[model samples]
Target chain A: MLHRGRIQAQGEDLEESESWAADTPPTWQEGIAMIDKLENKIPKKEADLRREAFEKARSFVTQAGENGGVNAVVQKTIMVKDSKEARVDIEVRKGKAFI
Target chain B: MVQHLFKDFLKNKRIYAENVGYWQSIVSELFAPTQIKAEAYLQTTFANGEPFLDGNPIFHFVVKKLNKAVRIVQEVAESDKLEITAWISNTELDEMEINELVIVLQLSEESKTIALDLIRTWILNDETVKNTKLKIKEINLTEEILAH
Candidate 1:
């Protein structure tokens, strides 16, 4: 036992901690409210991109609906990529209604 | 004959279906770019559990139709990013007769806050869709609503 106690650790704990330290109890409701508030701030540019992608998807579905046949299952899938290169995929189909 | 029925179904329900799915998908795709997980649910319930009226079915066919539409939209949203997955569901609320749709998304700690803020803004600012309102509620990890 070579005087290990005399040689103490010197470096600080720098690794990122996964746990969050809060003084008070974290309520589920509060966490949800916080998330809601954050989502509401999505940039206008991003919103517009999403809207455009949605419209394109709608158009595809409409066209498929327009051309329908008996016992026919119309299926259409489309992919939209935004300026950031994020891709969105949409798939639609119609057939016998089920409960 | 079947084609005619579907055509009529789509024509009568087109605008509603389009608006509902479009708005939900737009939000889904936007968040997808950030590798956040997002999903939308379109549900219908009959008032007082009454039978389907001549004007509207007890369970309006549109809800299911829109679910499929949203699925397609999610598919497109995923092409841009590998971090998002979207799901849609239909639930029958006993003795209730109102059509309800909800879009719920899961994101990283950083992205979660951003998404919540955007939804709050939309709820306060956007009123173009008639009789539609946006609400944000928490999902308990232990009590998951995604399966439903």
Candidate 2:
């Protein structure tokens, strides 16, 4: 399916637009990486900090699962500062990294 | 830029509905069964402004029949340019690599073309970035599912 929309904000609207661009949510890819990091962290001198991190990561994973696994809740709209345009094409074999 | 404006946009139900409606319309034509659901939530961000978990997805498109799927993500790079980043992946248990010739042979090229056109229209029709050229900024495979 194809989707389309134009975000045209003026004086006041521009403020809101910029905000949207700044804090756009992270994609599921990023979320999973975070969960993995939190779950596999070593318990050492920073036990308290580690626990806090665990709670934060657990909340994220729980949230993603509740919404529908990472696959379902994976979409993001962000704004960056760059001016390069190029189309990327990837090939995947059945059981390997990008090839 | 301002905190209140950002807060207002996040809470704006109208714009949220518009986003959901637009994606639903396009995804309906692309997949069978036409069962698409979208929900939005407020995610937390780090001091560096990176998004973290704590919210729901605004729109979810499920591909049941095809092993390959093309996911479109919208990003407004700066204020004038709209950068289109997409992920093309197959529902397999393997990691993929990138080269010159990719999924064009397996996945439906027709669908890819339609997706690009849709993004083009989004930029062309926008009042803010009108007359700007549309280009596909990046296409990559979805990150590998890590063991957690």
Candidate 3:
């Protein structure tokens, strides 16, 4: 499957491991490092455009709220992975967290 | 810039939804799934006022109020009246803008430990300057997430 910048072994491009140095397991860390180096070489606009995509797909946030009748997000967060729609919510009843 | 996007969102959520693929590509560059972690425990600050885990904090706070016959889909739900500080980010092609805002979220609920745990991974984890490598650039919150 297509993941990150590289095609999986199943795709048209080379498998990630093969694309790397003859040695080494070719971890994601290497992928990121390679990206960092490549970023410097790309045009500013292109580099920035690339960065923006990653930022949007991944968001880290928390919310906390107290002194509420039922819903006060004192400190909490809502993360919806691999989707564009919103997916963070909580329902508390009398000091308890439940599904 | 973030505020401007917020206004735009208010005008049309489909604005971004309209061109999801294009928008996704832009945001894709800034984060990788590995960098995007979901583990909350009552605290979170993606960007320190200083970049990459600096003690200094720059927060994008926003507040949203409940509006017009609010409703949701859930078997059980309770709500609280909340005043909030929201933070958000918007990817406009080559430009990435982040901002902090303040708004009120009306119609909320009070929670206890047991129920809170149910949604812990999604919201209540704590990650900040002292913990993760995530930086605090700018935060732009949306009303859709806050509206009661």
**All candidates: TM-score:** 0.20, 0.31, 0.18
Which candidate tops lDDT? 2
Q: Which stretches of candidate 2 lie over 4 Å from their true place?
A: A1-99, B1-9, B27-58, B75-78, B92-148
lDDT scores for all predictions? Answer: 0.27, 0.29, 0.23
Sort all candidates by DockQ, best to worst.
2, 3, 1
Q: Please tell me how candidate 2 rates in CAPRI terms.
A: incorrect
DockQ of each: 0.02, 0.06, 0.04
Give, for candidate 3 chain A, the lowest lDDT window spanning 10 residues.
Answer: A61-70
For model 1, the stretches where C-alpha displacement exceeds 4 angstroms are A1-83, A86-88, A93-99, B1-106, B127-148
Specify the highest-DockQ model's number: 2
Give one digit per residue, the lDDT tens place, for model 1 in A1-99: 110000011012211101112333222233233323322344444434445544543343233233331111111222233231322222111121111
Report, to 2 decimal places, the DockQ of model 1. Answer: 0.02
Interface Cα RMSD in Å, per prediction:
14.3, 10.8, 14.2
User: For residues B37-109, what per-residue lDDT tens digits would candidate 3 score against the true structure?
Assistant: 3211111222222111110111112211111010111111112322222222221111222121111121123
lDDT of 2 by residue, B10-116 (tens): 34556545644655665555433434232222122332344432122333332223222334433211232122233232222123221110111111233334453
Clashing pairs in 2: A1-B26, A95-B94, A96-B94, A96-B95, A97-B95, A97-B96, A98-B96, A98-B97, A99-B96, A99-B97
Candidate 1 lDDT: 0.27
True contacts kept of each: 0.00, 0.06, 0.06
